[model samples]
Target: MTPTVSGSRLKSTVAALAADRFAGRRVGTPGGRAAGRWLAGQLRAIGASVTTDEFPVAGVRELYRTPEFAWSAGSTHRRGVHRRNFAEHLVSADLPAPRTGELAVADSDEWRAKWVLAPDLGVAARARFEGAAGLLVPRGTDAEGWMPKMIAGPPVGALPVIAVRTGLHDEMARAGSGTVTASMPLRTVEVIGSNVHGVLREPAAGSPGVLLTAHFDGVGDDPQQRLPAAADNASGVAVVLEAARLLAPLLPDHVGLAASLLDGEEAGARGAAHHAPNVRSGTYVLNVDGAAQLGDGAAVEAGGPAHDLLAALDQTGRETGVPLRAGAMPSDNRRYAAAGLPAIGIGMGMPGYQTPAETADRVETATLVAATRLVVATVLRLAVHSRGLIALPHKDELQREG
Candidate 1:
């Protein structure tokens, strides 16, 4: 009989991950560690031997306090709201106290503690300044006017960088020169991340085996707001768990399958980075990044030597009536691909993305069912391929070759 995933179980799992107690499951936090243990327990319940690999992650951005920013251009003065009119940037320098400086368009001038109006400071952009109080870069908001959150990016502490909404930035630009006061309570810290691996079954001799991966960490809750992170990745993890629950007992006895619930993804996929090198190059890896809102099709990105695995997924998708399209998924799957493993990343849709508006209610049950079914079917197909590709050589053919 074909295995089927329980949609109710998947939904409950998503809710558990998005619950306020997990505090958005940021790596190294109590909430994050608890989440890892909880997932390990779930795997144990599914009759899998679970183990954890600990890895160190550095330069994780933490917003200790909401920033205070106000500016004046001769006659007009405005105070901006956090995540609405302005938000923190990853490259911001630590500035806890209030800082006041004159605003000048970022250029080849000696800034000398003046705040500059610059959008992005690449290596080329950074070379143009020496000492600037901070930067006010124009940033776009989501359709709902919420600035998405990020816990990782390029290095910080070069200078305080703040992202301002386009309208406010344009106003500051039209004024030509302005005075500004801002405070950044943001800091970067080092933390340890743990990856949970569950062994569902062992591969038969010569089988390449199959691995399922998903990041369970979110960007973490805002200091004051609750960012459920139901879609960004909780949905993906839920799908993997449900797929594992359904596929373990039904897979061919010789076929090997395992699930990797990763961490530090919000801070740059450190969990996968650490886990990838230990995996063999020929292993087939399938990573689910998002499965909350499936639109017309699911996005699929193949990396490394993934032709066979991708083909299997494509065939399975067709048979299951889940559309698949080529697209980019910059998630944990890329790390596995980098290690020369056959890896593919899949994403359906993320309704609210990384903003506080990302609630559990928006995740679609149909999408979860479709995603789980797709994963289960693809694993079964790959198991068949494993058996076919690694069969014993015919005695006559072997003798003739010899």
Candidate 2:
């Protein structure tokens, strides 16, 4: 008999991961370490053997303080709210204190010691205004008018670059003559990240194993606001934990089952990249990234040799009534796939992705339950099929998986 997934348990897990106590669970922070410990304890509580893998990561982004921003046009001063009106660009130079300067329009010749406002920021613009105080680059916002946060990107630029909402950016660019003050206490640091692994069962000799994964780290909360990160990954972690809890006893004898709660996924999936090389051969990987909403269908991206595994997922979705579709999921699964393992990445939907508005209350319990059920069912099929208890689907049977 199949074990049932508990929605209430999933909610509690998400709340614990997204709570203020963890401070957004950024990789390499005390909060992140505490979160990893908590997850290890959870796995142990379920009677699984838990172990952690540590890896060194360089150049992780850290924001020490809330940045201040404002602009003035003929005494009409306006202070832009962080996240709502503007955000720090990943390539921005460090500026702890606000720097004020006159605003220079796009066609202005006097670019020295001024804030250049342009429709877009480019290498040419940076070289042209190398002496300017900073740049006011216009960027688009999400439908909800929020500028998302990013930790990894290209090398820092020579001048501070701030992203303003298109409307605010255009306003500043057209104002032509104005005074602007901006600051960003952002810097890079080297840190160690951890990946928590829990073993539920080991496959019989010559049998393929299954690895379930979900990143437990967030971009971290801003100094001024609480970025709960409930949907971005806490939700996905909850689903994985719930599936592990229910799948522990029901997993077949020939099937090896384990769960990996990863860190540093927000820093360009460094943790997965570090852990992939150690995965046993002939292992099938399933990674869940977003489970807060199941709009349209769950997005699936298969990498490496996963045709048979993708067919099993497709067959599972049809039986379970959860829709699956083709979509891009650039997450940790790619790392395992690169290691010559069969890996599949799944994403549902996230509401305030990587923003201050990502609160736990917005997560849908129904979606959580659905995601857990799908994962559980798929694992049962794949693990059991490895022992010839069930026949694997033909390659032509797989479709709608990217």
Candidate 3:
């Protein structure tokens, strides 16, 4: 279940993190880390047991490394080829003496030698990545790679090699058509990072748990630039922090409310996925993200056993006159739902999402306060009143998918 909180207090909290100091809260960036720390602090102040759970992830290379390779015709291709001392590790290889060098354009076997070079990186071309030596990629050539588009790093899989300018390879070819050694020192490994938490223990015996969740990572504009996730999530983190302070003590023991500010929502759900193993059953999750702006607010409804909770929220909004609407999928709500827990997302709407315009123009302080109050009230009621499994109608979309 959820807990009851003061609206005024939550609004003030949201404003503080949205300030410039938080620096847009982009995930994995300094500003984003700072915001996460700030969120943990707020929860701790409310007397919750805060724990930052760190997980490891693979970090791709910042620059591509290509080494020159040559062979003396009929010298018999080298048995094994691999990049060493590169930024990441060599996980697996699909071909030996992988294709990467000047090769007779006509032979299929020659394609393997050419494979060492990063090709145009089309879907069909990458299929050959495993068979090549060093990829003979054209320098200054703008070609896609075989991997998801990432803002910070290189493609995650395959062996190592560098793409060089055709001129450079041509020069090498002229030097001696013999055997040229090709290699790239690439490394791949999991690095440790964390998600901090603050917990306000409910009175010893009330009900199941209610988690007020938010992800602190920000992926901002500027492919090379860090995301200043101010509105993307710093605002939401701030609100969750403040909510914890006012409502922690009031929560009954049977109804525990955890102010769970998450991490790594940016790098493909790393943090949430890590924490999933430990979450208790029968929990209710109210996730907040991209809600910093104060425009006409929105409330995302959880399809199961949480509809009455929405009604209470509607009542609170009507009473407070804060403009709160209904929205679709947001953040951590998806994770909880997948775990079979009742969950919903609530926030302020951003117009041009994923851009600077997505940020909050105003705090819409009253509306935020009203929304928090509503969630808290509903949580308490569900914790105390629902006798059996109280399943609400799943939202239209969730039902259709089911």
Candidate 4:
């Protein structure tokens, strides 16, 4: 029997997870911890036995306040507004103190000890600005006039890199050259992130289980701005929670179902990496990353020993009237695949990815329902198929039949 998912429930969950109170749900922050606790409560309400796994996350940078950038043009001071006129590069190094120096173009040799203004900061430009005091690189805006936010991955170099708007760059160019003052104060600290793991049934020896997973963390909010990453991941978690509610009562006694709401996925899938080792071998994992919008149905990426899993997904989609297409999603699914588990990554759509414009209202409830139905159908189909395979004859019996 196909379990009915409530669209209203999905919308409410998305709203709760993406609310301003959650503080963008960034891992290692107070708001992030609050979001995790809220999600754990939701899981318990859905009748799943829940536990949390904690992992250490280091080098997380939070903007203490809006960064300030100003310059002198013929005795008139010009300032750039944070997020509007300028933004910070995630990999930029923290300045010991406010830097004040004459602005120079990247081509000028004097820029080595001055604030260099560059059109873009590619690898070559970054290399050239190695010895410079700092860089003012212009970043292109999207159609919505919002600057794309970036996550600090690995440390690029020692130089501080700030992304200014192209208009600001033009203004500085028109001024010829002037003394520029830029201040970016960031708080770098380490904290522990938690992953909520809930199971409907415990697995028996040599029994294969099904895993449904999603990351609940988003990019932390700016000091003065709200970045509710609803579509990027909150929507996904909402759908997964709905599926867990529907599957708990319907799953067979021999079939095991587990859901992992992970953290630190925005920080390079750190939570998934930590949880992968504890996954039982031969588990089939379905990881949902985005589920608010649909673009030609759901996008699915399969890896590891996923032949059976892929077939079940296709059949389930056909039976459930959900569309499925092949797509690559380099998310937490890859972590499970790397651990030699059959894994598939699913994404419906990401309307406003990693930006301040992302809001809970933008998440479509119908898309969430569709995603939930697809996941439930796939799990049921796989559970039956796996049981059949386990019941198949041994090699000695097959040889006798031959």
Candidate 5:
């Protein structure tokens, strides 16, 4: 009989990881480090041989305080809420000090030293406002008034960019000559991130093993509020932990089980990039992300020489009555795939991704249980096949045969 994963345990684990003390689990912050320590402790408690891989990451943005934005039209003034009303761009430049300027439309020359408010600004418009005080764009929001949190991307223009709610933008538009003042103080820091590794069983020489992985880091919270990235990642980590606990006693000697709780996934997948090259060549890797809100079934994306592994996963899903389908998940599994390893990425669902509304309460316990069951079942199926596993031909061997 397969060991059961307790729903209460899964819920508690998610609660612990998504608690306020973790401060959204951002890579370089004190809260992030605390979360890592907590995870390491949990892995050790599971009686698995645990270790950590430490690495240095640079150019990580740390939000120090609540960014402020206010617009004044003559004698009337209004302030924008941090997350609900507006949010700072991920790559926004640090304001040396508070700056105030009149709100002007994009096409007007008055945007020289003023806050340029527009529905959308194209590349040419961005170049035109290279000397402007700042740029403000109106963005759509969900029913709860939550806007999409920005992620770090390519280099932006010199002027800082901020996104405000469409209502706020309309208000600013009505105040044709309103003065807008904004402040977003930030600091770039070099920080050490760690990947927690726990081994359930050691593989024999020349024996291929299975790896379970999930990223635990999230977008750090703003000064005034917590992001509580429960669905984005904590849900997945909870499932992995439960699976490890249940599989420890049943893993076959020739087939090893290893789990990695990675960091800096939100910061351009730095943790995955650092780990992929070091993975043993023939190891099978499965990365679970966003497993909280399951919609019909789990989404699985496979790459490289993973025919046998994918087939086993599909079979296990069918036998266990869990739905599985092909989908695109551009996550840590890609790192392993790039290194010629058989890799699969799994995604269940994420309701409020990278936003403040992603609370622990939103996580579905039923989804968590199903995801954990699927992983456990898949691992057991792989173990049974490992005894007679035939290695796929190498590229060189296939080319010679052709």
Candidate 6:
């Protein structure tokens, strides 16, 4: 007999996964890697096929070596001009260094100028001036005090661009020689990444395959700190895992119940974008991300024929006394929807979103379990409904469409 996912088990899983040490599971960090590994282990325990796909991100640097700058102050050289601490700065390449009379922005630049003064553009400007591989941004100030704001300039060519702390910029300002030397170490390579999958493939009367997806990666504001992404995503991944465990045995032999723990959803939705072109026709999908809070319900975001799927899910929630809300795509559901495939997104409730409390203790276990059951039953029922007219395309038919 297949193991049934129980509330007790899910609770334990949630508690263990949400432990303090995980540090919010932010993407591109050690914590995020730990979260991904944990997710892989969970899916493995449930017999899922797993594979990690690696890709490269351009113009990114890791805090490996700090660049030093110094200048001559009269006869005495006042050493140490600029410095900062950050894992990496996203910058553009091909910018020049500052020389006497080089254009520079002060605290009085217009907000629009500041807004457009993005690091990418700064790299471009620096490159235009110095013809360097990248730009060294000593954090500068705007109209306000030390705050995060974009720096504007032309597009920096292939060179990498990065932003350092304002303290560093002040040091550069003191370079009496009217020249500044900035240095930065860059990280460019292929890193290990992954995509988790669970499938219940079988033959059913005429049922089309159904797919469910959620990205396990979390984005973080701080490059160094661990982001305990409890609400942003850990919750969504949990829902998908629980659903797979519960529905595995009940799926019809001729039908397919597939779940994916996609990677790189934070880095430009690369994972979802990869899955789009490969979407199978006649396949239905439910994409869940973000945590759900207690007292609140899961939002439904599918329209068109897919709306029927949402309605069916909502109806099942009602029958089971689960409070599920309706809404639009907020996750990977956009992938399938954009592909013209039937798809929807389901999310949890939270007070301050993207924070730990956002995925608070309000996820109704009973409702979640009931929701899974309903999804399984509804998929089967819909498959049976579509079997009659949802023609199975022959090789010729597929070739013609292709």
Judge candidate 3 against the unseen true structure and give its global Cα lDDT, from 0 to 1.
Answer: 0.52
> What local lDDT score does residue 328 receive in model 6, on the 0 to 100 scale?
59
lDDT of 5 by residue, 247-325 (tens): 7776767777889999988877889889989988889888999888888888999987888789878987886677998
**lDDT of each candidate versus the true structure:** 0.86, 0.85, 0.52, 0.82, 0.80, 0.52
Structural similarity to truth (TM-score) of each candidate: 0.91, 0.95, 0.58, 0.89, 0.90, 0.60
Model 1's alpha-carbon lDDT is 0.86
Question: Which residue pairs of candidate 1 clash?
Answer: 93-159
Q: Candidate 1 lDDT, tens digit per residue, 1-402?
A: 334467788888989999999998999898899999999999999988999999999999998887889998877989988888899988888889889988878662667778888756653245335667878888999999989999998877577888899999998887878789999889999999999999988788776688999999999887787788899889999989988887787676777889999999998899999999998658899999999998999999999999888998899888777899999999999999999999999999998999888888999888988888888778777776666533321112211000
Each candidate's number of clashing pairs is 1, 0, 61, 0, 0, 38
Candidate 3 deviation (Cα RMSD)? 11.4
Q: How far in Å is the alpha carbon of 254 misplaced in model 5?
A: 0.8
Query: lDDT by residue for model 3 over 1-402, one digit each (tens)?
Result: 233344445555655555566555545556656777777777767777878877765452221233224444464443211111111122222222324454422224444544333333342244354354433434332222111112234354454434444545454344433343554433333444468876677434435777788777654333222223455566677666755664555555556778777776765666766775567776677777755555655656564456655665665455445567676754677777667677777767543343333344444555455445545445644555544433322112111000
TM-score of 4: 0.89
Q: Which stretches of candidate 2 lie over 4 Å from their true place?
A: 123-130, 388-402
Model with the higher TM-score, candidate 3 or 4: 4
Estimate, for each residue in 1-402, the C-alpha lDDT of model 4 and write its tens digit.
334678888889899988989989889889999999999999899888999999998877767777878888788677877776778876677764678888887667566667888776654355454567788888877766677665546665466778888877888887778988887766566778999998878766667798999999998798888899899899999989988887777666677888999999988798999999889988999999999888688889999899999998898788767788998898999999999999999999988788887888889877888888788878877777655432322112211000
RMSD of each: 7.2, 4.2, 11.4, 7.2, 7.2, 10.8
Top TM-score hit: 2
lDDT of 6 by residue, 335-366 (tens): 77877788877775533343323343555455
Task: Give the per-residue Cα lDDT of candidate 1 at 288.
Answer: 97
Give the distance in Å from residue 85's predicted Cα in candidate 5 to where it truly belongs: 1.4
- In terms of TM-score, which candidate is stronger, 1 or 6? 1
